[model samples]
Target: MKKQDVSKCALLLSLFLAASSSQLVHAEEPVSDTASNLATNVAEKLPSADMNSESSDINVTTNQLDATLAPKAEAITTETSEKASSEASQSDTMAQTPVEGQSLNLRILSTTDLHTNLVNYDYYQDMPSQKLGLAKTAVLIDEARKENSNVVLVDNGDILQGTPVIMAGKYGDHLGLIDLEITFQNGKWSVNKDKSHAQIRKIDTKSELADASIVEIAKEAHDGTVAYVRKQVGTTSAPITSYFALVKDDPSIQIVNNAQRWYAAKELAGTAEANLPLLSAAVPFKAGTRNDPSAYTDIPVGPIAIKNVADLYLYDNVTAILKVNGADLKEWLEMAAGQFNTINPSNKEAQNLVNTEFRTYNFDVIDGVTYEFDVTQANKYDKDGNLVNPNSSRVRNLKYMGKEVTADQEFIVVTNNYRASGNFPGVKNATVNRLLKLENRQAIIDYIVSEKTINPSADNNWYFADTINGLDLRFLSADKAKDLIANSKDIAYVGPSATAGFSDFTFTYMKPDQMTSMTSTGMSQADRQAIHQLAAKVYKETRSSGQMQASLPKTGQKQSTGLAILGMTLVGLVALFKKPRKQN
Candidate 1:
């Protein structure tokens, strides 16, 4: 053939042979980028002129090229497919490796509400407790760290006296052996007058302790002293005072009641009510030392200590300010009034003044408003703030500064975060104007520190309605309450109660004006009519069973008297105030 044709044929044959020879020798595979570059160079080198002149020779050479490289191409394609499958399998293995977990194990060590119990010792009981103290927890923490290289330790606040008094109250009351009534004098708990009722005592509330998930710890710690149960989740502080004393009907002994009100009045009286001061109120539970109000008693009208502050404000609830209308404010008090069971005027048998099911912590008394709860009528809301008796009107004579509160009139109320967060009926729709950084308990402490001396005297802003003229109500309180009960017309101290460390007291219904407030107990025309009808109905129903079976929402009943009072209609009130309840 011609020289150019022979050169073209030689070049094509050499390229094909080189490719085939590489595959035959099992040389390193050419990467995709390198193979693409080689093909581009080979195409550039082939001239169009040479291809035209050497068509016949190129056809003969192409046949030989295809025959020789066909096997190599097949082998290369097979090997490529196998390599791609292997790579795909490796990628899948990597993707699934995370699901099998890691080599290192992580451990978390945590404790909370230590309450300054650093040593394995009980300061109040004067005893050693192996179950409490950070020192005891340290050993376990070290063990945890040693077992796992990846470990974290965390403490969840409530240091010092920031611990809640309600916890101590529940523990003491449920155990029924801890002396919550022990007074503070000379920087120590006052010695029990009755030697048998000592501060340090054994507790056997097995069911309660177990339900609390601290039975084992309590058993180990309770050595003739208050339980010093310590665990990772929750811990208890030393009980310094009575938790239930704050909610006592006898405002005289209610140190916490006046303290909370006084704190709000002094610190949280917002600028909105500057012309006419705002009221501070909270719904604190009566956990212990519930008593009768017969005689008046003061906190010696002297300087208060920091320790006493813990008794006044029991929880860690932060302060919150709510701008509410008079109507909703009255409704708030009505929800609080649910703490008391309806008192049947006609019932002769002894009836409980306070609803045991209704937690006393919900009974809110506005410091600036004078209100009376007519127990003769049904409660408007349940303990959870559900409107059970849509037509029932229990809140009566609700007035601010001797004037009847109007629906349109706005007022500021000082309360805690828990109360302000739409937890109760009247307060659910109230606008939270501001939330303060100070906790309720811390505020009380600060107030005492600022004042140095405080007189926690109740203004008797709230009381029961005088409509039940002569119903003798019976309530239980700590035995020490007997000393404070003066022989008054309204209250009479009964003998020791069957319950250990408790006493019974008889309280007769009387006018609020007779006791504290000079403001007349005037009733609206609607309240008078409702009261008359209720009295008549109770008289008829209670005569047979000596009990007025009023369908109160708190009692889980669906029926109610639906009595209308105070001209405050309940139309659309439910929809206006309904909100999702939160767990405390």
Candidate 2:
């Protein structure tokens, strides 16, 4: 072959190979679309010389190229077409197959702040309310579930307390403390033994000695560890009154046994809230109520009924959880510290322990963190969370797990929706993790039912710091302090005050460490000595009332002291867990 003819053959071969590669790259198209176009392109590009010239050599080379590449092009086209078809089939199968880890859709249902309205009925107005009750919410929950096959339910708290309906029935009769009139017979003082008779019915002095003295008789009555003598029921013309032994657990006997103080203790509400997410809680309370001294709930500890739950949590606030830093936690405590009045450490005259102007509900005690308020220093914030005294700080030794809480250390705090949104200092701007659908009261009830027997004991996590040095701190409480002061190491009965139905109690604030040992199960030497003096004083007062007698009552004939049981009940509260949901 000639050199020029050889170069033309090589160029034709290279062009055919390039066109085939391009056609295969877009092989999804029909074979007829490009296969004929490749042949026509090579023929057009050849020089058009007449019969026996150099162009005839090019034409011969093109004919030779077509012969050499035809079979190869046909094979490439067939292979490309089959591969495309197979890929299309595979894609169709893939589209129809179920994914192993596909996401799903889920719906969350919630209700909160039921506030003792378990049913639709309202006791105060004596009518059924459509807007009330957790039962009513069940229908809505069902509808929500139907909309989404995957669903979850949650509650935010504040279900137990509030609503006069909860207070109008049997639970309304809070038999706080029972005063049993015991007489010394055969050198042994005795009172009623049966707890049922001891609580509702009056002490039958006529009956034989069940146990020695009021304390021993009270200890034998296992129905409740405490007894309270409710001074007077609100506005009842014929209110029952009695003198009952104020046992340690008896809320009515103490001068200050209200929901605010009771739930603030670490054992009851604190433990319940903490246990939900296994985190700390910052529970708040007011210093006073609309009813003041008359507004008190004292439920017995024996059998927990529906009415008892109402006495514990006194609100309709929904539960909430906030993620806050330790510094913010401290600020929240500062706002709560406004509950107390700044005391002059050097003053000898008695001063009020609490600020009467501060609302009780605003006072928050953060459980799981050990802290104290130095009442001697002015409060850093007012009840409304406004910075009152910028230079002053009352919260001292704020700690978590025995270590000082760092400014940026994060913590999850359980609280009600009211406090979370109320713009309280440190808590107002907190990052809310969840706003639950559950009521606070219902949470308490659920917790009670699960535990069966609850011991609402104070862990003494917080207290006033060193108020006993030369400061004659005093606070007003129920007149029942006369019976309870003997056992208390921090409180001294200071006689009846001018305020009707109230008494003056000297607040002998002890060091936190001293408090544990002094108020322990076993009495201290000082406690023993104080008890002896207090016993004589209580005996003389009893004798003066003409209630105590040396002679025993006629055998088997029970005597009524005109003391009726006061209505009291408690409810548990707070905390809910998150349910896993499908993403859809």
Highest TM-score model number: 1
- Give the poorly placed runs of model 2, Cα more than 4 Å off: 1-288, 518-584
lDDT of 1 by residue, 49-132 (tens): 111111111011111222111111110111232343344333222222111111212222234433434445543334555434
Provide the clashing-pair count of each candidate structure.
Answer: 4, 47
Local accuracy by lDDT, each model: 0.43, 0.40
Clashing pairs in 1: 244-288, 283-361, 284-361, 285-361
Tens digit of per-residue lDDT, candidate 2, span 48-89? 211111100001011112221111111111123234334433
TM-score of each: 0.48, 0.44
Worst 10 residues of 1 by lDDT: 52-61
What residue runs in model 1 are displaced by over 4 Å at the alpha carbon? 1-276, 284-286, 289-303, 517-584
